[model samples]
Target: MPTAAFTTLGCKVNQYETQKILESFEAQGFEIVPFDSPADVYVVNTCSVTQSAEAKSRQTIRRAARQNPNAIVVMTGCYAQFTLRRGETLAEAHLVVPNPDKLRTVEYVLEHFPHLKAQLEQARQRGETPVRRRSRAVLKIQDGCNIYCSFCSIPYTRPVMRSVPYQDVLEEARAMVADGYREIVLTGVLIGDYGAATGSGGPDLAELCAMLTAIEGLERLRISSIEPTQVTDHLIELTATNPKMCPHFHIPLQSGDSRVLKAMNRPYDQAFYLELIQRIRARIPNCAISTDIMVGFPGEDEAAFQNTCKVVEQVEFCRAHLFRYSPRPDTPAEAMRDQVPEPVKSERIQQLQQVAKAAARRYAARFIGTTERVLVESRSKLSGLMTGTSDHYLQVEFAASPSLAGQLVHVRITDLTPDGVLGELVALQ
Candidate 1:
């Protein structure tokens, strides 16, 4: 049997797609090996989310090539998608299948090693194991993005908003639940904008939440990252009522200044975002509201940057991802004249990041002495510690063994650290 290795980079959507590809390869009797291991084939799943991500993708591809110089090197994902659109030469891969139908790619690999066909057939007939082990299973309910935010490269790399059929989503959810996964994070390029396309008379995110909550044995369902504009009243209401849904909202607030937001083509402004956050807190008390902020956007002046800082301080988010604006090729922001200097952008990112860290510490402090339900994910690599996530997505660490990996237990928050919450595990009940 021909051995193959795969490496993936970037978002949960990419990770989910890579998992599907891996399953397909496994079914074809391809012995899955580590990326560092020499193999007959190596697949590098690329990412173009940021310049760093693209650089990493190229680095991984080169590393894979070095591992097995004679092997067939295949590269796909966002970087390949963007490069192909630009008519750029993809020299790394022997067969550059640019976003080829995933299943077809697997079949192409199988054809080269026909002797493994009988084993592949047997594996397919037997089916995958029911109880698979995973700390967190990403369930991609949607794919692609429609709204072309000026600063984003996603719409170009993953154009259009396409939702997985509701029935298919339910089936996948059920499967994950049956596989002993305690937490299923609903992920996508544009998760909140799910069901907007296709016009299939399917349920919106609120309905999807309700449906998933009804599924028996599923301990938690988390919304990966949602847009501020997509935080509908219905969705907020559903989250308020749904016991299974995590009380953590990560809404992307690219900029606080309306002018900056308009330049970036983001759908919501500070006032609108604040209102949404207020509503969510009003309904779901103790909810950890988080956000994504982009500093030094095109046309962002001192006032605009200060405006973003003010909003961040005012909102006092539980946590925030602060990013310095990096213009992607073919995006509107790249064409704009008033791009901030690198030093200034970096300084502002640091300032905002400090504020976010402070907010996170404050949020974690509130949970000190409170008991929370946490699903133990893994034994900590540090020492005899075990780590897990609380219902509100706060990381909790305590002493545990490998046997408690998949169990949900109540933990009393004893200390608040900069990195995570230190907890004492209560009875396993």
Candidate 2:
């Protein structure tokens, strides 16, 4: 059988698209292999979220080429669009699929490389359809982002706003549940903008979640990442009260400084963000609130950086994805005055990371001695012990049978680890 390899970068949206693309290739009798292994074809779902991401994307493409010089290297995703915008050509990429047309990458590859199609036709394919591994499956229900955050390039790359039809979403969710996935994470560029951008003409995000919980085999539902402005009371209540909903919220607080927020054209202020968190905690006790924080934005002085540190201490996020701001070409923030030096950005990131880690520890410590529900994923690469994510987003590791990999079980949090907490198996839930 013809072999294929794939890798994805950036966000969950890219991952969902890559999964769909992989499914398409497998349906065409392609034998999927590891990206590092030599294959007849290689697809790199690239990201241009930051300059570093772009560099990594390019490096990944080059690595694919080195793996098999004769292989067809395909590049699709945000960085693909960025490459075209920069008027640059990647010699290693034989097929450069457009970002918006990423889902159709397999078709582009098959059509261009007829020999691979002929090879697949000659060999008998034995794969009994590829099952998405483990328990959690990401379902992309919405596409395109219109928020246009000044520091962000996603809106530029994915300008169209469209929600997957409710029926289609329901069908996919049912199929995922049937495929033995216990948890479904709903992902999108701006997921909270589900109905508004171009109107789904059906259920909004909260209503969609309500509909999804009806799927019999789906043990959990999670909203990957949402903006602070989009968390409505109805959604909060559903997440707090719904038995199937994971009590973890990934709301991106790009910057905690009100001045930096305004400069970045964010709608909410510091007070509004803090108030929102307060309301969330009031409704859902011990809910894990995770976030993405960007450091060293233009004009983010010591006072502004301290303001961000204060919010990190205040919210006590379960996890915070701390990244330094990098100027995307043609973005508003790129031309802004007083761009913090790289040294300052690095220092602030280190400082913020320390504060964020402390806050996360404080958040995780609350669950010590409490029995939390976890969908046992797999063994830890570092600890070699069974590790899985708790309902509240803690990575709980404990001694367990390999047979219990995909089941929802209870783990009694015994003590804290550096990342999360070491736990003991309580009972299967």
Candidate 3:
């Protein structure tokens, strides 16, 4: 059988796209292998979210090429799209698929690599079953972002706004559930901006979640990441009340300073962001609020940086993704004055990371001794305990059998780990 390996970088949206692309290849009789292993083909879903991301994407492509010198290396995603848009090419990529047509990457592969097509045809001709392994699925219900945050390249790359039809989304969710996936994370570029704008005759994001929860066998539904402005009150209430909807919110607060937020062209101010989070917590006690924080934006003085630290302390996020501000080509922030020195950015990153870590630990400490429903995902490499995410998005681990990998079980929080909470199995829920 023809072998192929896949790797994904960047956001949940990229992960979802990679899954779909992999499924397409599987249907064509490609044997999936680990990225480290030698394979007939390699696919890297690249990201260009930041300069570092672009560098990592390139490095991944080169590594895939080195993994199998003769293997066909396929690159697709934001980085690939950016390179192609500039009339440049990645030397390591044998076949570069653009982001706009990423879902059809398998087709592009077949068109570019004919020997693999023959291998797939021969495998199918011999009547072999396609390999399929999935426990948690990511369903992208929306795509494209219109909110042009100055430091982000997503708007330039995915300028259009589109929402997947309600019927199509429901069908996919039902199919995934039937396929034995206990969890489905709804992902999109701007997921909260679902419906109306794209002419999809569908309900809004909250209503869509309500519809998705009705799918039998779907034990968990997660909203990957949402903008602060787009997270409506209705959505908060639904998440607070709905058992199917995971009690986790990944709202990106790029910067906590209002001046920095304005510089980034984010709509809401720091006060608005804080108040929104407060409202969410008020409705849902102990709900996990995760966020993305971009540090060292242009013109961010000590006062502005301190303002961000204050917000981090106040919000006490369950998780915080800290990013150093990287200038993207053609963005307004690229030309802004008072660009923070690398030394200053590094220092601020350390400071913010310490604050964020402390806040996360404090938030997690509250749940110790309480039982939470956890979907066992994998065995922890360090602790040898089965680790999975709880209903509130907290990472909880406990001693359990391998057979319970996909089931939802109760875990009583026992102790606090550096990154998450350790727990013991209470009972199956």
Candidate 4:
């Protein structure tokens, strides 16, 4: 059978889309392989979220070409879309599918390689089992962002606003549950904006979660990320009360300084963000609050950076994704004065990284000796132990058989590892 490999860069939306495209390939009788291995075809779902992301995207494309010199390399996602929009080309990619045509990637593949179509037909005749990956599935409920943050290029790359219909979402959730997926991560460009512009007659995000939780076999539902301003009281209450809703919120706090937030066009301030975290913690015990923090924005001086450290100290996020700001072409932030020097950016990132690490350790320490329900995802390579995620979104490692990969089990947290918590299998709960 012909083999294909897919690698995704950037956010959960891209991850979800890559999964969808992967399934499309399997439907056409393609055997999925690891990205590092040689394959007949390679697909790179690219990201242009930052300069580093774009560089990585290019690097991955080149790696794919080198992995199998004769393989067909396809590039899609934000970076590819940006390149195509600017009338540029990636010489490494055999085909470049724009963001708007991302869903039709498989079609492009079959069209470009007619012999692959014949191979797919032959595999169908043989009725061989198609290769699959992932125990947890990502379901994209919405797409496109209207919030044009000054530092972001996503709004420009994915400008259209639309929501998947409520019926379609429910149907897909049921299908995924039937396929033995215990968890579903709901993803989108601006997920909180669901049901606003498209008039898809779908339920709002909260209502959609409520509906999804009712699926009999659905063990967990995770919201990938949400704008701080878009996290509503209804969603908070629903997550607090719903057993299927994972008590984990990943709300991006790009910067904690009020002036930085304003310049970045974020709707919430440090005060609002702090209060929101307090509310979530108050309502849901052991809830893990994760966030994204961008250091070294255009005007982020010592005072602004200090404010961010203060917020990190206050919130004590369980996990913080820290990165230095990279100017995107044509964005307002790119033209803004007071751009921090590279050395200053490096210094600030180091300081913030220490703050975030300390905060994470402190938060993880609080859960020591507590029992957590962990849905076993896979085994850890570092420690050779069964690994999974707790309802609170903590990475947990315990001893168990491979058979327990998709099962939820009770685990007693004994120690905090560098990445997450180490636990022992208590009982299946």
Q: Give per-candidate clash totals.
A: 0, 0, 0, 0
Which ranges in model 3 have alpha carbons more than 4 Å from their true place? 1-3, 31-41, 62-73, 85-95, 107-131
Ranked by TM-score, the better of candidates 1 and 2 is: 2
Q: In candidate 3, what are the lDDT values of residues 1-429, reduced to their tens digit?
A: 898899999999889989889888887889877687899989999988887788899999999999799999999998898899899887889998988899998999899878888888888889887655556789998989988999887788788899999999999999988887899999999998998668456699999999999888888899999999888888988998888988899999988899899989999999999999888889988789999999899999999999999999999999998888899889889999999999999999999999999999999999998999998877777888888889888888789996787788999998899889999898996
lDDT of 4 by residue, 258-290 (tens): 999999999889999999998888998768899
lDDT of each: 0.79, 0.89, 0.89, 0.89
Per-residue lDDT of model 1, residues 1-429, tens digit only:
567788888777777777778767765567776576898788778887777678788888888878888888877887877778888765666655566554356766557545446655665577632223355577888878878999887788678668888888889989878867777888887888777455324888888888887889887888989988888888887778877888888888888898999889988777998888788889988788878788888889989888888887777777777767788878898999988998898788888888778777777888999999898876665645888888887889998776787788899999976677999988784
Judged by TM-score, which candidate is best?
Answer: 4
Instruction: Spell out the clash pairs found in candidate 1.
Output: none
CA RMSD, predictions in order: 4.5, 3.3, 2.9, 2.8
**Count of backbone collisions in candidate 2:** 0
Q: What TM-score quantifies how close candidate 1 is to the native fold?
A: 0.80
Order the candidates by lDDT, highest first — what do you get?
A: 4, 2, 3, 1
Better of 1 and 4 by TM-score: 4
Q: How are the candidates ranked when ordered by TM-score, highest leading?
A: 4, 3, 2, 1
Query: How much is the lDDT of residue 353 in candidate 1?
Result: 85
Lowest lDDT block of 10, candidate 2: 124-133
For candidate 2, write residues 1-429 as lDDT tens digits. 778998998888888888788878877878777676789999999988887788889999999999899999999998998798778999999989988888899889889988887777777544334333457888998888887889987788679999998888999999988878899999998899887346676788999999999899899999999989999999999998899999889998988999999999998999999999999999999889999999999999999999999999999999998878999878999999999999999999999999999999999999998999999987776787898999999999999986788889999999999999999998998
